[model samples]
Target: MIDAIRDYWNHRIHDLEMTDQPVGTKRFFEDLDEYRFDKLHYLPRLVDFSGFRGQRLLEVGCGIGTDLVRFAKGGARVTGVDLSQTAIDLARKNFELNGVNAEELVAGNGEALPYADASFDVVYGHGVIQYTADAPRLIQELHRVLKPGGTGLFMVYNRVSWLNALSKVMQVALEHEDAPVLTKYSIGEFRQLLAPFAETSIVPERFPVKSRLHKGWKGVAFNTMFVGTFNALPRAWVRPLGWHLMAMCRK
Candidate 1:
């Protein structure tokens, strides 16, 4: 099962790379600050990476190495591992393009990572854990690789959120086959999963405009309803009701 998924990802990334173009100069500048803002907003909420500076950092499932680039540029000696060879290639290319030097970028599975135990000061995976067949084993591997007091950061789809339930209805009842399946979790479930190796905290946060409305009145209505309901909530409440969940655990 893992091999099949890895193959699928490799093929998919290869295809994406063939047609890939850098985010245009204008759009890049506009979006650049937003990513930094997001990092700032979420970093404090997550674990502190500042203390881990000069220590080894490992990123799992680093698709095209976007965050990997950020980490390397931030000054930690970094290595990025992915199951997709195409992704590794693109990540290496991205490192060269961005003038950031990663310690290494290699192809490897999350289920069985290729590294020594207690090898990293921080293990980071953004939007990658939900796709795994076994979330526990994957987290265990992450734990095994972290040194004492090291931290791991993960971002996953929130199942309890309103947006997720709505997406399920639209996908099943409305026959939206193109919609992605997001594995959602309650705060308790998330904490339980990571309890083996570290103290855990789950921070729920919403990402506005995850996708655009499709076409007609139906799409517009759905979009408006979601925006109206969520937009008025206080930022403090937003995390618990948000579409995405982020967890930080210290080993």
Candidate 2:
């Protein structure tokens, strides 16, 4: 099971080569910071890496090390793990290319982390656990590695989103296939997975992002019709329809 996903991501890394960032010409880290701000709005929330000076921070499933580089540049003692060696290697290159220092980048499973229990001040993962064979078990590992009261922030796809409906109608049910594990989490299900943590809360994130299914004006038009207008709707109205659900936990 693990090998299947690892191979999938390895092929993915080769095809995409790097994590997507906002296009601009700046110092590497500067570009990344702007990219994160525009996409994640992460200065004071969702793992709060900006406040992580001198703390031990672990990013499980740290793909290509984009966020790990940001945290390291902010002075966190950063460590990252990814199930794909292709991702791990690219992440190492990203850190070195930007002249940021991370404590380690290991290719490892989140379900059985290599570190000792209660060893980290912060554990973070984004768009990660849903793809693991056992999402609940990975949550246990997240709890295990955190110091008492340590923070864990994770994001997974929301099962009730427009994307979920569209994918089922246009991609899965239309083709007579089961939805993959990545599409498995409803808000209640994700909250239940995080229940064992000391204090856990879930919030919706990134209502529905623009799609890359096609390029140019056609893509823009599809996005405007299917997502853009709805994405701009105020959170109070769209909270329940959000495409990504963020879980914040303390262990």
Q: Give each model a TM-score.
A: 0.80, 0.83
Candidate with the greatest TM-score versus the true structure: 2
**Per-residue CA lDDT of candidate 2, range 62-165, in tens?**
97787898799889999999998988987887888788898999999999998999999999988778777788888899889999988888888788876577
Task: For candidate 2, give the lDDT of residue 35.
Answer: 56
List residue ranges in candidate 1 displaced over 4 A: 13-52, 172-182, 213-215, 236-238
lDDT of 1 by residue, 1-251 (tens): 66766776766642232222354232342254345445336554454544456779999988777677767767788999888787788778778877879888999888788889999989998767776667889899999999999888888767677667776776523222222323557777877787875487777775554233255665776667766766667777666766667887789
Which candidate number would show the highest lDDT if scored against the true structure? 2
C-alpha lDDT (0 to 100) for residue 159 of candidate 1? 66
For residue 30, model 2's alpha carbon misses the true position, in angstroms, by 7.9
Each model's lDDT comes to 0.70, 0.75
| Candidate 2 runs further than 4 Å off | 14-37, 41-45, 169-183, 215-220
